[model samples]
Every structure is written in structure tokens, then in C-alpha cells.
Target: MKKRRFWTRKQWCSGILLAFFLAAQTFVLSGCGNDPAATSQEESDNLVIATSFYPMYIMVLNVTQDIPGVEAVNVTGTVTGCLHDYQLTTNDLKKIHKAQILVVNGAHMESFLDQVIAQQPELKIVDASEGIELIEDNHHEKNAHIWVSISLAMEQVQNIADQLAATDPNNAQGYQSNAQNYIRKLEELKSEMHAQLDSLEDRNIVTFHEAFPYFAQEFGLNIVATVEREPGSEPVAAELKETIDIIRQSGVRAIFVEPQYSTKAAETIATETGAQVYTLDPAVTGPEEPEAYIEIMNRNLQVLLEALGS
Candidate 1:
């Protein structure tokens, strides 16, 4: 469901942060720390680790795949798009009720996290964004798209692994080993991207929105502009015109469109500037198969490689 239209983004973010703090305080009061008995007891064959969305689901799944006592589930199942506009449903609450822990993307990405906390205050939370530096827009809002960068994604995975290890000390070694192996694979992918786009003449791109600041920063590319002031919202004409002007002035050759939102705004800019529009997967959701994160990222990288003429 949409937030109350009257509330500003800053208000929503502040509320979520307050909820997180209150939830955390309750968890501490419930005595979740240093209680080996409770920790081990919770690590049963049905150790339910519920993730906020697709990205968290995949990473948690990979961490718990080999451990017989653990299982990963998405609080919202098979989300076909980004969670920025998602509303929590009764079924979502039911899933949360069955979960022992909730894994969140945690840079204000899960706007509905407060509802889950309100429902289950003692629920363990594993914030994957913990300790990772974030990209902020001029408004100082965290970009909340850390997984787009391979290096940042590695940090998130390590954070998840560390959380799992601490929660389930019985499988701590396995969690740590699995995280290292996955991290190494991600490193290889990063190297591939660097090698492929290392010498491109056209490294400037425009996004539908600010989904790729971390990605661009990591890969040494310039984001000339973003077509939309907010993802999934109709563009304000002045904002669109400003972006179009940025594209025209920068001589940017491509504008990237994400799968979750309409390409109309990007198309408008491309039409105005004679730039090509290319589709890029943000890896927000994936098929039921394993390694979905790596697969989608590789696909996005290929799209970039082709656009950059590398």
C-alpha cells in the first residue's frame, strides 16, 4: 500500500529508523544475547530465515543451503519487481509470523520493515547493509542499492555470513567458509568487468533513476543524469528537461532502463538526445534456480560491456 500521500520521504525514513531502534531495544530486553541455549534451540531443522526481498533471499539461501538445520525464505515471495513501492499483505505477515529471523537490505530499502517489527518485536534481524558505506544523493538519502556493486555486494554477503555465524554458532565455520567462497567468485566477476570495460571510450550513462551510483562509482563510469526524480513516478517536466539537457551537454551515448519500471522517461530523454536506451536488470527478483544473483549481475555486465563497445 502507498504511504500516506501527505508524508514526506524524510518522515517515512525517520519512522522506519525509529521502529528499527525500538525493535532492537526490545530484542535486547528479551535477552537474545549470549544465550547459547536459546540460539542453539532456534537453529533447528526448520531454522526459518525470512528475507525482506529477492536480493536478501538469494544471499541468505546461499549461506544456509548446505546447513541442514537452516532454511531461507522470502517474507514476500517471488517479488517480480523492486520493493520500493511494495506494501505488506496479510500473507506477508503470516510468513513473518513463522520466521525466526528477518534479513533486511537495511539502508531504508524495506519501507514496510516497521510493520514487521510491530508485529514481531522479538524477531531477530540481520541487516546486510551493516557497516557498508552507502552512496547518498544531494538530498542525503542513502542510495539503498548496495548490491549493484560487486565490491559492495561482497561486503553485504560477508555481513550476512557474520550474522548467521553469530546466531548459529554450531554452523559458524560452515557459514564463514561458504561466504569466503562466494566472495571469491564475486571477485572473479568484478575482475571480468574491469577487464572487459577497462578501455572503453564511452563510459558515461544515464539511468532511469539513481539505482547505479555505487555501481558506476565501483566501475569507474560517469552517470550523466537520471531521467526520473523518483522511480515509478511520472517525471516532473522540469526535472525531465533538466536531465535531457544534461544528457545533451554530456554527449552521453546510452540511457539505461531497469526492468522494474517503465522506460517512457528514458525513451523521452533518448529521443531528445539521440541516445540509445538499453535495459539493465537490477537483480531485484529472479527465477527459483540457484546463483540467481550472479547470473543477473553477469547479464547486466554484458549489457554494459556491449554498450561501452568493449
Candidate 2:
């Protein structure tokens, strides 16, 4: 016969306590293996790229396409048009502060650049307009609208890719590959536009402002007159009369205005000169999509064909 043994209450309680302690130890070990500090370091390693405006944002988007741990954000968002007289907001400052790099059109396009550099001295800047020959604005200052020209825009993309690669050597190949892909598309568009625009006998044009000189130079269109020397400022009576006279004498049938500005001045000139008013986008502002620049430029080409093909 076998005698049955019963455990004491103290023994039972100690066994239960030991089991609980082992379970807690396992949980702590699992948590430690994950290492929250390591996760935070990985998050901080991601590159935050802040573009000064829309065009630069698009360029960065193309340059950084499909690159892991890279983000492109526009400081001025999608709605803001042109950085000519733009003022930075508090939210904008925060974005810039968090960014590891800032991509700008350069050529003095960013009026607040000096202030930004002063505030964030350690911030790396990639100027897209670097090394490209810039067209002069109405004021004789170098125009920052280099992206408006497809050829120059390709150059800017290459410049940005090169600078970004230099700044972030870890992602150098990604930047160069993406930039080359984008530049191929730009080259196709440039050839198509040149093929169409080169045959046009009527190359002289009248624009609303000084935004399109580089674009005109790319396609060999002559900008005989601009309605406004500067954006948001209407031409004076004498200046308006001079533009009308030039349009009349140049036999320019079209008066081009930007979608971002009021068409009143263009319309007034058109009414007096009997020229039709058309829209030409400078690609300063548009949809937030990466392909927005290409779409806008294609639309501009259609508008040019309609306005000038006659």
C-alpha cells in the first residue's frame, strides 16, 4: 500500500510566489529585448527634408522617390505661390527646425534665406538653382524661376541630386538614380515642346509679369513686353500704354497672365490691344502631387499652341 502525501500551505504559497516571479522576469526580459531607446534612435535617423516652396518640393520628391527613411515637406505647402515676398509663419519655422535639410530655388529667390541661415546655422541647404545660368528679371536681378524651363529644371534636378548625395552619402545612389529617371522625362518633355514651339512663326509674346523669361528663353519665344514689372503690382498708366503699344506693334495676338494673379491688368491691356488673354503657369503653385509640374507645363504648352499657333 502507498501512503498519499499532502503539501503544506506554506509550501504551496511559496511555489505560487516563485511561479509569479519567473513570469514577471520573463516579461521584463522580453521588454528589454525590444529596447525602446533603440526604436527612438531609428526614428531619429530618418531624414526630414523641408523644401522652401512648391517647385523645390516637387524636385525633392522626384529625387527622393521610394527612398526609405526620407520625407519631403513643403514649408509653404501647396497653396502658397512664389517666395518673392513670402513671410515665414510659426508653423513654417517649426517645420524648418525639425528638418535635417532645406532645399531652395536659390538665386535670391528665398528672400528670408539669410534669416533662416542665421536661426539654423547647422542646417544643410541644397540649392536647386546652383550653377544654372539665370535669366534677369525686369529689375535686372537674377530671376529665381529657373524651374520654369524644362532644360534648366533638369539641370536643377541634377544639382539637387548631387548636393543631396554629398550631404547624405548613405543615400547617394538613390538620389542620383531617381534624379536621372526624372530628368529623362523632363528631356522628353523638352524635346516635345521645342519641336512644337520652334516651328511657330509668331514667337513674340506678352506676359503678365517677369516670371516667364527663362521659360521663353528655353523655347526661343520672345517676350516683347510684360504687363507688370513685378507680381501683384499693376503697371502704371504709362507702362500699360507702353505694353499696349508694343503688343500692337509686335502684332502679338496673345496676352499671357498667371493663374495666381488677377487678370484685370492683362484684360485691360488685351481690351485696348485687341489681343486674347491666356494663362501660363509658372509652376510656383499647384496640386501637391509629384507630377504636378509636368502636368502644369503640358497644360501651358497646350495654351501656347492655342494662343500662338494661330
Candidate 3:
């Protein structure tokens, strides 16, 4: 109890060495716990789905709603209209590269698809219009504006859900359930539209462009004439006169124009033919909400009723 033991120099040095080694080990463990690579790895585990444009983006939103660990994004952000001659930006490429899947409205809608496939050969693609019959444009190219038709849009929705389920088996049930719920809403809208439109005597309409052939076909409305064969290309004097003549001859009372394009041509034709101008949205672009498509279609139905209802 009275004697105090002193440590040898060797023992002291060994103790110091052991303390240093323990401290270094602790520092290394803490550093690894906060590594940025670990965080990046966690983020990479998420299933990212990228859509080609606005319409497909909305479809994916409906299909993947509330599915955990699934992120849906659009390649083209806030694009105001159809992708007729759309060019991809570097940002778009980056988004596509980071995604695990790319959903597109097929049937030649995306003119840049070949370039995309060449660039990203490993990317999985889901074509929404894979099985739907497409209307041909004047140039004999398949019209890719299938989503404008509610019935056709419903089919596209189902196609998307099926492909998504096949691609991501872990969330298959969720995708199918969400698609069924959305399709039911679409069915209700279609029934309502048919009930109102089927009995109209004046079914003849003149459209601003060729965007509404599918829409006209869906409701049995005859497109007597079109103001423009292609969007953004105003009709020359001769074509305008011819369209006016056709509208007058067919007794077409309404000229339908898309919200995405200028209404100057439609207004000119309406003035010349005494037909009223109305907005019929193709839903190529609109609010970035989950229910934007349904809402836009509802508005279009009202517009049709006003323009066509006697």
C-alpha cells in the first residue's frame, strides 16, 4: 500500500503507440461514416423513370404515384407544344442517362429516338403507343398524336402500365392498381362525352391543323376542312380560300384550334366562313399536375358542347 510503481520508458512508449493507433482507427471509421460515395450509392439505388415529354410524363406520374423508391421525371421540361421537330439538349441527355427507364409516345412521335438509342444502347424503353392504331398524316407518316383521343389515351395508359409492370416487377401490383383507377375515370369521361356528342346533328368541324383527326374520329365528328396542314405554317392565300369554300359548303359551324398554337389562322377562317372559333386542347402541354390530362379533356368537352351543341 505504501510503495508506488513507476512504468519503464519502453512501457510508456508502447502505451503511447497503442493510444495513437486507437485514435487513428477511430478517426478512419468516423470519416468513412460520412463519405460522399456512400450517399451517392444510396441515391443510385432508387428506380428513376424518365419520360420523353409532357404527355408521357403525366402518364408515368399516374402510373407510379405513391410508389416508394420510384422517381419519375420528364426529359423535356416545360415544353409548350408538340415535339414535332424537337431537339434534345445536354440537360435532356443527362436526365436520360441517369434514368433506369425511358418512356416515349412511339409511332414516330419522337424523331430523335434513333439518336437516343445510339447514345444509350443499354437504356430500357417503354412505348406507350405500341399497340394502338395510329392515324396517318398527309405525308403518310403515322400520326403520333394518339393521346388526343380519350379512348386511345386510355389504351396508351394501359400499355404504359403493363410495360412498367413488366420492367419493374417489384412494383407491378401498384402500377396495375393505379392504372385501373385512372382508366375508370377516363371511361367515365368518355361515356359522358359520347352521350352528349353522339346525337348532334351538326357534326362537321373545321380544325386549325391536323392535330384533331384522332379526336374527331373518336367522337364521330367530321372534319370538313383544316386551316393548316401543319402547325406554325399558315395557309397561303389559295389554301385559305379553298378552306373557306369547303367550310361554307359543308355548313361547318365551328373552327377548333389548339391552345398550344396561335389562333390567327382559325380566326381568319372563322371570319371568312361565319364559323365560331373554339379551343380544343390536345394536352401536349399544360399544368404539371397529376390530373392535368383529365382536367384538360373535361374542358375540351365543354368547349365542344358549346361549339357543336344546338
List TM-score per model, in order: 0.83, 0.85, 0.84
Q: What are the per-residue Cα lDDT tens digits for candidate 3 across 1-310? A: 8665598788999788657544533432343313434334544345678999998999899998887667788999887678877888989987887676899989888878678777777678999998788888668878788888999889989999999888777678889999999999889999998988899888888877777889889999998888888787788999999999998888889998888788888888888889899988888888878899999988988998899888
The Cα RMSD in angstroms, rounded to one decimal, for candidate 3 relative to the true structure is: 13.5
**Residue-wise C-alpha lDDT for candidate 1, range 106-186, written one tens digit per residue:** 999987778768768768899999998888789888889888888998899999999988876767787889888888988
The digit string of per-residue lDDT tens for model 2 on 270-310 reads: 89989999999999988877788999999999999999995
lDDT of 1: 0.80
- Candidate topping lDDT: 2
- List the global CA lDDT of all models: 0.80, 0.83, 0.83
TM-score of 3: 0.84
287: Cα error in model 2, Å: 1.2
Runs of candidate 1 with Cα error greater than 4 angstroms are 1-45
Clash statistics: count for each candidate: 1, 0, 0
For candidate 2, give the lDDT of residue 242.
92
Ranking by lDDT: 2, 3, 1
